[model samples]
Target: MDLYAPFVRHVVAPLHALYEGNPIYSILRELEQTQWLSPEELRRRQWEKLERMVRHAGDRCPFYRERFAAAGLDPARFTLEDFQRLPALTKADIRKETPRLQAEGMQDVRIRQGRTGGSTSVPLEFVVDERSAQRKGACALRHNAWAGWHPGDKVAMVWGATDVDSTFKLRMRNLILDRRFALDTLRLDEAMMHDFARRMRSEQPRVVYGHSHSTYILACFMKKHGYAAPTVKTVVSTSTVLADVERAEIENMFQCKVFDRYGCEEVSLISSECDRHEGMHINLDHLFVEFLQNGRPVGPGECGEIHLTDLTNVAMPFLRYKVEDAGTPTAHVCSCGRGMPMMEKVQGRVADFIVTPDGRVIFGVSILDNFTAKFMGLERVQIIQDVIDHLIVKIVRGEGFDEKVVRGFQDRIPEFFGKEMRYDLEFVDEIPREISGKYRFTISKIPNPFQEAAGRAIGRTPPA
Candidate 1:
């Protein structure tokens, strides 16, 4: 038996169990249990929560209070219909008003500062209080529940960040949470991957969760090399768009369901696909989601920008916050019996949309899918658009990278764009990580004023 197995079962398991019973956890658990409410009931409850949040912010948050006053809006009489009347708050708005947003009488309003890994180069710093933190943790647990993960189920995380310090509190928390593996995604070498495969086979984790791109890359290597790992019940991909090709390959290679999750740092676990394999279930109990087109709410099944209001985050409430992601709204009920609203798909983040010289826009994931089939053992790559007619391809060459693959991409790109664009292929040993430690596959240096304005409104700079 592994040396840490006993500690994991006894100490970590019990601690996680205790944490799962915390007040906030209980509240979230109750909501999840009631997720089968009728559509009308769900809407009623959502408005109630929204009203409470408006009142709370109007009283406690100096920023929202003043904004409401200047707009001649009364928080006490705020209605669901007035959602459009409220000004959208972007990441920039939050950053600019952080000082005023701080709770007045609370000396320790500093709580905790966290960074958002936005597609735009500009990251954000936000404060979270104890209640907010607990709510976030509970939301994560609820998502885990969809994959048959229990309170004490052993879990492994393949994450990008390398700043985890094993302090006493963290150590205790890990023990309680039954977390066995915390592999650093930055060091994804053959040896590291082999070691991870061995650990997974030995530990038999209930679920494996991580950045989709990195995990899919690892799975691809394992499948090509015929390395067998322990069977996980499910794999949850977060923080990036999971292309259909990647999803098919991952599911086949790992022998598990590939569940894609859409969320941001401001509100963790906003929507997740359930076991029924339906669309991503929006957490209506804790969030009020709006799909807007040109500043107006769109009807069901229409594509639009995603705006969200966090009902649980009282510390620094985010009201009608622009998340900068596009998706199609769905009013269709799920067979899974969950009354939570669903989103048909999260069309990739705003930065992933590339404008061509001919004014044609292409989705980043679509281009990657077209190229992946022609390339073998390509570890990572980045596509940079400097101008309408020029593109820089940064390739992190892997074991079998050859001229054939390069020529294939070179030929296919122009064929798709219908123009002979300048394509530069620069091969490197490894793609450099961003300041947040995650790699962005697409960036644009050319300034689109509209995109820049949108990015600024959301507190992120246009991706470049």
Candidate 2:
């Protein structure tokens, strides 16, 4: 057992929170209790927060005030229905009205500027006030607890180069308080994995945390080289989509439960899996989440684009902000008994959807997770759709790759896509990671169905 975990959780964390003048530890305590509230009660509390944030935005944020007036809508008496009718906020809007989006009377508050990783598109620069930052931090701590992690417990992190803090001050803090060591996925190779494995043997961290694909890759490398996998308490997969195959392999190698997490840079900790692992529970305390098909609300189990309203970010309000991601809402309650609602899983980024020649928009994640990863001889594969009628497949072959494997793969493509579609298979040494150090399983260049639906919803004609 981690004997020091209790001291870090109880004493050191609270002291650090006091030194920073933040209420993160206090907020975490509230979260700990609220998770067990009834679903209806949780929704009621969520609505109250939403109502307060909306009113504050209308009164103080110039962008929202003008927008509310332009739409002939009053935020003071805005109903859920009226909120749905309001135009969705886009990344373009934030870029155009950064200054005006900030709530007034924040001169005394500390603000921090941040940006998206831009793995799929251009990077988006935005700001979050100190209060919102604290709330996000607390929410993350609550999720970490679900994975049985505590601040003082040693952690092995596999993440992007930009995410790791290597400053001398942070290094000292890591040694004493945070207790984390990171492997930069940007420069990951067999050598780096070996070094990480050796460190795991020495440090013996209780938890393994990392981007989904990066963690899976590390596990594969360890298995291939006959490295003895450490017995960790739990693994947390974040940043990218965690496929079923990837999760199973990581769990098998680590000898631990994998807690899949979903979030974005703009809004931290959107949702995370509890111990039940049935589905990810949305963070209702900080966000008002909506699922839309086109511009309208979608029912449970139906695929829809996810829009988020930051109920906590009074510094820069993001109302009905379209995140360009798709997911399905669940009507079933998790056995974990958390009142927070569940989302089945993220489908994929809107841009990652492959539009077939027959006008079918299939989720890219489903293709890779359900079909591609099951192929025995294929170590990794990426699909690129530059034209409606064709696909370019990049394959990283494993030991048993042969003509039979090629024929078998060709046989399955027409089943998902129509017989009218054609594809070219390019055998590769390896699939390259994006500049953000995240891997993309599929990239479609064609205009997706969601774009057309969004254009129609906003009363604008989509590009021909």
TM-score of each: 0.87, 0.94
Off by over 4 Å in 2: 162-165, 450-464
Candidate 1's clash total is 7
Highest-scoring model, lDDT: 2
**Over the stretch 131-223, how does candidate 2's per-residue lDDT look in tens digits?**
888888888889989989877778888887733366878777767788778888888787888999989888888989888878998888888
Clashing pairs in 1: 12-175, 12-176, 16-176, 91-458, 91-459, 92-459, 201-230
lDDT string, candidate 1, 1-464, tens digits: 34564565456555654765545457556767877788789989888988888888888888988889877778899656665688899877977898887555666643666666433566678877766666666676777677665555566667765333367776665555545575677665678878888787777776677777767777787787787856777788876667787788888877889887877777776788989877899988778999888888889888788899988777778899887777788877889888888997776542345677877776666677775556785877888888878888888887788888887887787887657577788877877665444566667666542354223212211010
Native RMSD of candidate 2 (Å): 4.9
Q: What is the alpha-carbon lDDT of model 2 when measured against the actual structure?
A: 0.81
How well does candidate 2 match the true structure in TM-score terms?
0.94
Candidate 1 residue runs with Cα over 4 Å from true position: 1-21, 105-112, 117-123, 162-165, 371-377, 396-407, 448-464
